[model samples]
Target: MPIRTEAWPQGTPCWIDCQVDDPAKAGEFYAELFGWEIQDGGPESGGYLMAAKSGAAAAGIGPKPEPMAGSPSVWTTYFAVDDADASAEAVARAGGRLVVPAFDVMEFGRMFVAADPTGAVFAVWQARGHNGAAWYSEHGGYVWNELHTHDFDAAKKFYRDIFGYTYTDFDLGDEKYVTFTPPARTESVGGISDDSAARGEPAAYWLTWFQFDDVDAGAKRATELGGTVLQPPTDSPVGRSTLITAPQGEVFGIIDPSKRVGEMPAPTS
Candidate 1:
């Protein structure tokens, strides 16, 4: 389990947090769907609710951004880094746009928001008192992160330069996708491919896959929990999967890979 510890390459993915319109409702929705325990994260933290599993941190649920007043809900993913400033700089150098400048969060960590070269948004974190989500892929935690973009080559090059991600192409016969491997031999972090090629969809964005013990069971639970099935459960050469949209309409997927879930998977970019 050589998961990248808190002290790894300057910028690594250590956590993911999302902002929702109704924190209480989001909490209720996730608690019912993922069996997560949602509780008040305290006043200093803007009364944010921390989603935990078995008392361990998994992800986060916070109030949605102001600009998103009436828009559907969405989850913002955060990557761990040694220095948020440095990572932001890399993003700029890679042709990505910085949505927000790095700022401190009391004593928890430093963070900022940015979009990839393809316009998909995400966050970067530099932990101080707070490192990241305590729980991971195995049970209701994030299992994988992937990028579906318009330009595969440009997106791939940008991430490689920014996150030091190594690329490998996985041929899925009729169609193919690329996997982003991190610095070590551990589980690969996420994957990427041309959004148009992968699903024939025009919108380009990054996708995160939450790992489940049972793909079919998770799919059923997703529908029962007020989510819509974007793609029904199906198995591919890499793994078994199903795509679903949250109550607010943000899209993501669930995976039950052929290989058993191992330690922390590396980031794709």
Candidate 2:
């Protein structure tokens, strides 16, 4: 696996972190589940715990932001950008709502939180000293990040406006799924899927996926570590994936992407 030493290109999913109520418990849970070396970033960094795989940063666990304090724990995927302030402006112009305006992270980076026109929240990172995730897609690291929105067209247009993203649409059964490739990139890094009609009334949200060598075993281990298996391991074009929630109720997925079981739809963007 390639270890990313510097920041990712603009518009890619550079990093992901969860804001939970009990930081320590979150640390212990993920550490045991992924065999991560979790360590607290200390008081200066608000006691944020950095989870590393082989001494390179893999993900983060930290207390909720002041605005979201006491809210339900959840994971947020961040896109890399050249200037967070400019990106925030782009978000506003694209009809997205800003939950948190761009702000500095003590020289590591600048970031802001915002909800897409369809109401799915995400963040953008302007890296400085800290260059986001050191590596991804390996076992115990993030594999995919996707947005599940109610207004698929609006969400697609909003992100495209913000990041110059081009998409290839796919028909996933009766629902629509589209893989997005950022500007100047040849491959898709993430996807946008809106299946709310089939899923009933679940609110729009971005889904973060982590990889596991054994999908079933990962789901079983999650339950033993105080987590809940929201959906038992299921297979699709993406692979065998299980929708699971952490002990604190933050939803994420464990999937074995190598386990292909179906034909993928051709691009229709």
CA displacement after TM-score superposition, residue 228 of candidate 1 (Å): 0.9
Residue 13's C-alpha lDDT in candidate 2? 95
- The lDDT per prediction is 0.74, 0.89
Expressed as tens digits, the lDDT of each residue in 186-222 for candidate 2 is 9999999876685564567888999888999999999
- Model 2, clash count? 0
C-alpha TM-scores of all predictions = 0.86, 0.97
lDDT of 1 by residue, 29-89 (tens): 7787778999896787786888888877788888865544675566777877878898889
In terms of TM-score, the best-performing candidate is 2
Q: Estimate candidate 2's alpha-carbon lDDT, on a 0 to 1 scale.
A: 0.89
How far does residue 107 in candidate 2 sit from its true spot (Å)?
Answer: 2.0
Model 2 ranges with Cα > 4 A deviation? none
With candidate 1 superimposed using the best TM-score fit, by how many Å does residue 236's alpha carbon deviate from the native? 2.3
